[model samples]
Target: MSDQPRSYLVLASQRSGSTLLVESLRTTGQAGEPQEFFQYLPSTSLAPQPREWFAGVDDENILRLLAPWKPGTPSMETPQEWRARILDAGRTPNGVWGGKLMWNQTPLLTAWADGLAGRQADDPDAGDLKTAIEDVLGPDVLLVHVARKDTVAQAVSMWRAVQTQVWRGRADPEVDARAEYNADGIAHLHAILEDQERQWARWFGEAGVEPLEIDYHELASDTTGQVARVLVALGLDPELAPPPALQRQGNDRSNDWIERYRAERISV
Candidate 1:
């Protein structure tokens, strides 16, 4: 209802440096808490498990490396309740709201939005994606597209994470030590990451929406600058952007896996 934008959404995929950007944004007290609010699966009420990523892959070798699937309780919140929680949880005292949305979780968002729409009105347009986002976050939400240029590196990072179940900060040395490099597993994630990026681009093109774009390398190297850019877009003070503190999760092992996967793919 205010003239200033009160909500912002980060459009990104797994292991794309989105966490770094969001965490930085969150440090600024003015910026609303930017979390991966849409990653949960309605059926499991949990973010996708490690084995779930390799669902169609019948490779026992790859399957054996990933953590075994564990069932989770389903979310019981109705559309209105879910909407209220997300809106409240993501907001700061300043009334600004922020959250992250991956391409894979769009279905869950749309379904929840549809349920809300059905309850609110009989209008057919209320169930659309744009309408859904507006219905929950208001009409002036700033959209930010955080992306990684290198799919191989992204996939390699994701492969390691899926194995360890540690997405942020440092992983346990003993637990991370157990993660093995599987070319097929990395390749599988590479394809998924590529497709998710492609879908974001295509959707933006089709919808005629031009979001503020952030590159992974640029974000990593100049995190404060990147966060300032988003704050500027949101009509907030750029000086509120916090200095970068989080370190990159990638390391020598990730680099080795990237090179190995490239070499194996080239030979095939």
Candidate 2:
């Protein structure tokens, strides 16, 4: 039997079904809490964020440098709490815990320490995480990151989220995305996505971690099929029974109103 504890992460950006994917994973009784990795929501628009663990990283902001969540969310449980919850379920005999985090917070996550003997602030990408995984869980740890189309569409979905005041945990002060997403907003949004993608690609290439990339539209069109792809990548058959509490969304995605708004705003 493998001696390393089994753990994994789901990587994606905001407004890209990362949370919904988490919900799907939550169905596995013994899986784990769907963790939004990068907790700090950047108020300032910039490429490289405060690399607390990168080349200049010198402090203990492991979570801060990463997580981009509202600080005071009610349902926001600590990583340890999530781990304990899974352990309590007793379903994870191999100690497999699936946690998630977003890579869009790339500005911050480029530097993180898995609490091992060696330090790797220089190589803040897949290779470093793979190292940590090997030491603790061997090569069993998986790095799964999800990808969406582009900024224009992603902005539409994210904008809807801001307007509808979406929240998986405690609600934060509502943001008028209409006001937030203007001409300048569109420009910046594109920049952020591009920068994040660049870094993610580099990390994925150098880290030696196997990559799993999927489009959001593909997932929405066929939840069961797409999830099966994910499960297979995770080394399991995707055709598992659904959880009793799984709520199906009956909305038709064919009508993409928000996407229209994003396209219209491109000129202005």
* Residue-by-residue lDDT tens digits, candidate 1, 1-268: 3576889999999999989988999999888988888888888899999988988899998999887788998888998999999889999999989999999988778788878767444666654667778877878989999999988899999999999999999898999999999888888998999999999999898878899999999999899999999998888889988888587888998899889888888555
Backbone clash total for model 2 is 12
Residue 252 C-alpha lDDT in model 2 = 33
Q: What local lDDT does model 1 show for residue 261?
A: 87
Instruction: Give the number of the best model, judged by lDDT.
Output: 1
Best-matching candidate per TM-score: 1
Q: Which residues of candidate 2, in runs, are more than 4 Å off?
A: 1-5, 37-94, 106-129, 132-138, 160-181, 235-237, 241-268
- Tell me the TM-score of each prediction against the true structure: 0.95, 0.60
In angstroms, give how far residue 52 of model 1 lies from its true place.
1.0
